[model samples]
Target: LHNTSDYRVLLMDEDHDRMYVGTQDYIVSLDLHNINREPLIIHWPVSQQRRDDCVLSGKDQNGECANFICLIQPWNRTHLYVCGTGAYHPICSYVNRGRKAEDYIFHLEPGKVESGKGKCSYDPKLNSVSSLINRELYAGVYIDFMGTDAAIFRTMGPQTAMRTDQYNSRWLNDPEFIHAQLIPDSSERNDDKLYFFFREKASDSGSSAVYSRIGRICLNDDGGHCCLVNKWSTFLKARLICSVPGPDGIETHFDELHVKNPVIYAVFSSSGSVFKGSAVCVYSMTDIRTVFNGPFAHKEGPNYQWMPFTGKIPYPRPGTCPGGTFTPSMRSTKDYPDEVINFMRNHPTMYNSVYPVHKRPLVVRTNVNYEFTTITVDQVDAADGRYEVLFLGTDRGTVQKVIVLPKDEMEREELILEEVEVFKVSQQLYVGSTLGITQVTLHRCDVYGEACADCCLARDPYCAWDGKACSRYSASSKRRSRRQDVRHGNPIRQCRGYNSNANRKTMETEQYGVEGSSTFLECQPKSPQATIKWVLQREGSDRKKEIKSDERILRTDQGLLLRSLQLADGGIYQCTATENNFKHALVRVHLRVLNNETVNLVLTHSGLPMASLQGVGSPGTSRAPNPQYKDLLQLLSQPEMGVINQYCEGYWQRPANIEKQNLNKQQKDKPVREQRKPRNRRNHHTSWPQLPLLANHCQ
Candidate 1:
């Protein structure tokens, strides 16, 4: 962990309360509860000869010419099979730990290192996926030194080591593996299959196009006897389509895949840079099985397009497991006929593509700056029902927390907590980056607020209002007392008797402004989804009227802006927020407008220099004073001006050159202000006051 980079969470053993992490030149075992506890570290740097050879072959000395631990699979209860890019020469070894968690000892087993040619990738930059299934390693990796030959290999078991057809573009063309999952098709062990998710260059769609794919191989396959010896006979792949339908009869496809299983949650991104986007698609195991059982894709010749095979189907279909329920008599692929093996080799691609649930993506983000790189899902049993919570990682190093409502709507909330990659296990999240790993809780329910309405409107499945503060929700708790409505997020219906601030009076702040100057009333809502409205009642009028934007008055998210204040604008303005048909007043402002005569009298009585107030009433001056001075004169009342004058006298008594240097520094360091492009600048101006600057000299 000290001298390594590119840290990846490899395995989480909850029973032992340890999480295994693999990084460059090291394999680390961290305590699940407290990562700050000294981790069990193993230093496995590449040999000097391998590093020299890697550098001589034109790989980077610091980056590519180093041992990068990539795979750590549980071989048994006491051993783990670890693999790494040993400076471009892949190697594997067995790590020894004690049989029990209490007596665990972490060390590399001596003299057990072997070549990992087919089970690991030589280059650390290339993508590979592997799963240790029943002592057999099912891996999708590039098998050659130059990283050109990619294949799915089944090795290290009692059966003969079998792989996909080597150097065959029709089988796998430049595939970048994402994940490997072992899904049991039935109760029988032989019916279990290993599925690989990847994105590769499409052979049928020319060289530039890439497509997402889901490929599977039966666990019981033992290679064919004569036709395809030492090759997979039950290997079949199908296109995974995640696309958006367009009005022009064309579909925009997302081709890069990042997948997680048990209900496949796939995060995909568009390959093209011009249309940047990412989407989350959910695929069912039933849908994937149906596509593999459908017709196979066949090509007549080199010039012909791929079409569904209409020829006579062979018995015990090409993709069927050798010892499954369909063909229990055939114990292995070696028992299959030569004709069936030959047919399987020529047609490994399924004709029908697999579509996600709802025939569309669950979440889609287009024209965004960041692409989703990884994802994890949590299925929670809320007070109402069950809900799936998605934690999506973006390339810009932030996790987006999204929850799918019962009405097929998605509410996305972002946690800008860390700039690190996220991994979820059980109820906690482990985020890792070059700096280190940090553990985060799934929900910080106290952040919602102390009010029940706030907790109910948050719509978070993990949190609810328990007649007091917001806390974690449990299904076994008193459901009728806790308030949670994830489906509608209607706080009015959920927090009827629990809202404490429902009848509280709105606090009013007194604000003074000059007749020719400007002022702003500040009010911000607690919730982002709330709608804000401003209503004003005059000093004498009893009826209140809603304020609409005009040349003099403008509304903004922060508050209401009143420019060039007039006498008619003196009133009590209330800022109200409407959410779920519930109205609440956020703030109230009582405004008082002062005329030019009153402002001039206040400045004179304050004992300030007449030179600084020269342009207050006269209009024939060559150059006006700084506008900030006018703002200061408008803001200070008669009682406060005396103290302000004392501060100003001490501020101006400094040397002239010091003031000049300060002015120059301010002019040089001031940031360029951005202006709204659509609004007319002729009447609109800044309503908020700024720091006062005295440009006029006192003699």
Candidate 2:
């Protein structure tokens, strides 16, 4: 059985965990829970030689009859409807759901071609059977004496038999089964319209890949008696892709499909292989939704924004394929998608965050995509319904922790303010980003800093954390975050702030105009003080608030003299205050430096133009070494958008009449590291859709 060819089928009595399986050479009953794959075999009374002697007109003579089902789905606590895929596929025995070995019911009477021989028994079963919600069984299999093409068969349990005043339909005098699927309606249920899916092909046998056509064989309310000459006609034939996305973002594939639950989450791969970076997509209630943070590669602009509606846009729209907006890099102008540019210029929604599945995943071309190495959501604590902490899996296989506070905790900008907080959190989303899985939990979501423990899961299910052991908390009872009475290990204690250069205990600001220019207004702290405190821990709408004259509002080397100051002092000012020996103090101050706004411009043609050193003549042509650049540099050069970055040591835009040395360098260049791309690659080719399945009777 291990080396050559020995197959078997096992039917587990859902109630008692008893199982029965039939293979090419044998049939058996098993204790599935105590699995050793090697099942206990039950020998048949007939021998191999005698099998050939019997022939049924319903099927081919020499072929094995055991090709269908040998296991049974219990119709009740006591009975099972069983059969095999063999020529003599019969309602052989009904076993007690509790103990199969002791309760053998009855086998059907077999029919044969030549009077002396019995029915052919090749495989234990000749068809596949699935159960309905209430213990009734539906099978699609071939009947030897009937035909090579299979039909449908329906059998019910004791309760259903008495309730419907019936147990099974018939084929002539014998009850019949239809080999069709019972399709669930998308809407409006009608007991009269039961549908089924099937598989058929042009070839007869020996197939490498079976291209099957799924069809719906529908039955009317009065279809009860059509069993004798049962024939399933085609309905809607289709093929499901092999792979899909798991809840955790990994690509998962399907090896088989069953009637009980029919949904798929898989990816379309590059080489028809799995795990080659095949991002999984989920299909539920019909429409396909790709999981994970990626959109269509071609659709992302130089900025790589995720636009969920790219596919909905006109094909080859100004920003799409053939559209001028498809720049390989955000800095490149090569065939820049003017359509998308124009669309973006005209519609504000173009910049809104509407993530498309495969097309432009970015809703805007400016916000940098969040680089996730590993992002997991777990109930690291159970005290409350808080899943704020996110475990990020980096490419180096290093684990980074990040905590994302709910809207109730901070403003929406606070969420975006995180550069490294994307690193730490308490809840765990157990999936590696590099692992290439697509897991999305849809629980709840909002923009406010409110607690999202109870209500947030609906928006993003993955964010739901059951913290039975990690933290002491509870989910919000309603759609709102539950306000917790101050308790131990609360959010306040969970969130901590840190900055490395502890020795630099000072506050600084920007000055106005040239040196020795007009002074400005701002405050700065000096000397050693461990921490700079913010006057208001939570900032809100109004600017001013009531304050008492007593508390040490500001402390500094100059001793907190918050009055007139120099122009260079217009920036972030800090004051030192220590709490429990921790040099931590609350800070509250604002600074403004005056400066004339200026604009900078960087002209980009295919290449640099050649002309006089000072533009004395027409510029000659040469490919610009660096045409792709960030817009910030151009803004810094142009005097229009705003004044130059005050912190930088360089001037704003260069004067047009400047000398060679001043005009010959990149205006703004910063040192930033490079990132890695997905190692696994997959492509799901979805046309606006014209598939071969349309060739069937679907028309």
lDDT of 1: 0.78
What residue runs in model 1 are displaced by over 4 Å at the alpha carbon? 1-3, 97-104, 205-207, 301-303, 408-426, 433-436, 503-528, 534-575, 587-699
Residue-level lDDT for 27 in candidate 1: 88
For residues 64-177, write the lDDT of model 2, one tens digit per residue. Answer: 433333444554556544444434544344433444444543232234212111112223333343444356444444444444434444444332111111211111112112
Q: List the global CA lDDT of all models.
A: 0.78, 0.30
Model 2 misplacement above 4 A: 1-8, 24-29, 36-42, 45-49, 52-71, 87-91, 99-129, 132-137, 144-214, 217-234, 239-262, 265-281, 286-699
RMSD of each: 5.9, 27.0
Which number leads on lDDT?
1
TM-score of each: 0.83, 0.31
- Lowest-sum lDDT 10-residue window in model 2: 690-699
Q: For each candidate, how many residue pairs have backbone atoms clashing (under 3 Å)?
A: 0, 167
